[model samples]
Each structure stands twice: as C-alpha cells, then as structure tokens.
Target: MIVKTKAIVFSAIKYSEADLIVCCFTQDVGIKTYLLRNILKSKKSNLKTSYFQPLTQLDIVATNKDKGTLEYIREAKVLLPYSSLHTNIVKSSLVLFLAEMLKNCLREEEPNPILYMFLEESLQWLDEHEGVGNFHIYFLLRLSHFIGFYPDASNMKHDYFNILEGNFQETKTSEYCLEGETVENFKHFFNISVDDISSIKLSKTSRANLLELLLTYFKLHVQGYQRPKSLSIINQLFV
Candidate 1:
C-alpha cells in the first residue's frame, strides 16, 4: 500500500554496504521500518541521510506492505529542519538518548495518534529551545500518560510516589518509591515546561537519584523495559 505520512526517525542501521534499515514512528501508522536501497552510495544521498538522523521529522512517501516485511520509501523530505538539535552537542546527546529510550519503549506496531502527536510537538519544542536540561526528565514523565502509566498525581500532597502503583501515597509502598529529596524533585518536574526546564534546578546527586526513581517507575509499568546504555552519558552531559 502506498502511503504518505509524517514520521519521526527512531533509529537507523546500515543494511549491507549501501542500504539502510530505518525505523520510524509515523503519524498515520505508529511504527514502520523502511529499507532504503543503495541510499549511501547515491549522489543524492545527502538529503536522504539527513532525513534519517535521530529524531528528524520527515514527510515520507512509502510502500506499507503490512505483510510484516520491511517497507520501502519512494521519497522523503524534512518536515521540520532543526536549527540547534544537530549542531549543539548537549541537545544532540539528549535527542540520541531519547531516541534510544523510545526505540526500547515503543514496541507496538499499532497506530497511536496521540503518542505520535506528543512526540512530534515535544521534539519541535526541544529543537527550538535552549538550555533544556530537564527536557528528558519531563519528556519521559509526560510520555507515560500516552503510554498508559502516567504517574497518578491525584494524591500530590503525599510523601511518597509509589512506582509500582503509579501513584502518590501517604506511605511508601516499596523500595522503588521515591522519598525525601527525590520525591520533592519529582514534584518539581511536574510543574516545569520545556522553556522553564532550565530554571528548575537540582544538584547532580539529586538528579541522579531522580533518574533512578524514574527508571524504576518505568520498569514497574513497562514490560521488558531495559535501561538505556546512553543514560549515563546523557546524565554526565547534563550534570
């Protein structure tokens, strides 16, 4: 089936010597992988490669066979040309880490329009903003809403955030739950936006502790979830 849609590049891998396997989350189809033949060898490859960069947004014309086979792209063009995401080292690392996180977390093929929209908007926000230290932390937490496990903020006044139950509680439910400083930091994230993310400050130790709490929350709710190997690198860059 020939289809045209906006897609967010998730990850790309070299196929053979000249081909590439590109995994994308399309606005229309949720997740799809395309096989680009001889793309690296072609004279026009520069444009194609640019579109496949981590988190690049593209308008793609492709064939969706829906036979559980790799799809093929007929043409592609950048839908949103980022000004700073690729050039800035800190922003680039954040994009790479988030891409890896999504590659692991978004495993389903079914279409999720809401999740797609959230990612589309979030990436644009990240690209346009400067000093987005808290972007990933907020992105992951907000994404849980679309993925069906947003932390229950109903009991916001509570002293503990129970990771397993996905809610705030008066008392700790498990060791995974955040308490003391960690809980306080998590609450602060909820009140931040991409623009205001930098102003929401945290010491390096507190940030690391909150990351641990967030990862534990993800593990409890997301099946087969694994920690991103790039996490430590991202943490170091932000710190």
Candidate 2:
C-alpha cells in the first residue's frame, strides 16, 4: 500500500555505495525504515543527504509493505526547516544524542499519533529556542510519559523516587531509586516546559548526576536497552 505520513528521522545509514537506509518514526506507522536510492549520484534529485539529518521532520510518501522489510520512499520534503539545530554545536549534539536514544528505545511498528505529535512539537521548539541547556533532560522526562514508566508525581512529598516502580517513596529500597538532591532536581524537571528549560540551570556535577539517574531509570523500565554512546559527549558539552 502507498501511504503518506509525517515522519521524524531517527537515524540514517549508508546502503551499498550510492543508496541510503533511513529509519523514521511516522505518525501513521510508528517506526518505518525506507530505502533512498542513488541520490548521492545526482545533484538535481532534490532529496539531498542533508534531509536525513537527525530529527529532521519530513512529509513522506512511501510504500507501506508492513512485512518487516525496508520500504521505499516515493517522495520526501522537510516539514520544518531548522535554523539553528544543525548549526549550533550544543544543540546539534543534543539532537544527535536524542536521535540515538530514539533509535534504540522506539521499537514499535504500529502507529502512535500522540508520541509523534510530542516529538514534532519538541523538535520544533528546540529549533526555535536558544541556550536550551536542559532541553534533552526535559525531553527525556516528558518522553517517558509516552514510552511508559513516566514517574508518578502525585505523591511528591516523598524522600525518594523509585525508578523501577515509577513512584515516590519515603524510604530507599535499592539502587534504582534516587534520593536527596537528585530527587529534588527530578521534581524541578517534571514541572518545567520548553520555554522554561533555558532558564532552569544546573551545575555541571548536578547535571551529570541527574543524567546518570535518568539513564538508570530508563534501563529499569525499558527492556534490552543500553545507554546511548553519544551520552558521554553530551555530558561533556554541558561541562
């Protein structure tokens, strides 16, 4: 079936010598990988390699085989042309890290319209904003809502956040729960928006600590998940 959808580019890999394999998270089909043939050999093809950059949203027409094999793109165009995400080093690293995270974490092949919308809005917000040091931290927190295991914030008066159970607790149970300063920062992140992300600052040590805590939280909830390789680079950028 030929289908049209809005897709967020998760990652792209070179196929053979002239083609490319692009994996995208689509609104109508969850996650789909498409084969772009021989655009590297033609300057007039209009589907330049630049379009496959991390988290670049695109309107795509493709063959939806749905047989667990790579589909082919009939047409593609940028849905949002970013002004700063690709050019700014800090923002670009954040994008790369987030993209890698999605590549590993997003495994469904069915449509998730809400998740697609959340990512679309978040990426657009990232592109339009500046000095968004805490953007990825906030994004990961919010993304947990859709990916399952969003922290239960109703009982916020507790002393610790139990990562595996996704709730607050007055007593520490194991290595999975975050206590003290990390819990406080997690609470702060839960209440922030993209507009407020830039203003909410973190010391290098605190930021690094929170990131490790978040990764631990993700590993406990997401099965077969591994830490993103770009995580170290992202942490260094903040320091």
Which lDDT values do the candidates have, in the order given?
A: 0.86, 0.88
Q: RMSD to native for every prediction?
A: 1.6, 1.3
Cα displacement (Å) at residue 15, model 2? 1.7
Model 2 stretches astray by more than 4 angstroms: 44-46
Alpha-carbon shift of residue 187 in model 2 (angstroms):
1.0
Superposition error at 183 for model 2 (Å)? 1.6
Deviation (Å) of 114 in candidate 1: 2.1
lDDT of 2 at 5: 93
Error of 1 at 10 (Å): 0.3
lDDT of 1 by residue, 98-176 (tens): 9988987897688898888889889889888777877888999988888889887889899988888888889876785
* Candidate 1 Cα misplacement greater than 4 A, ranges: 44-47
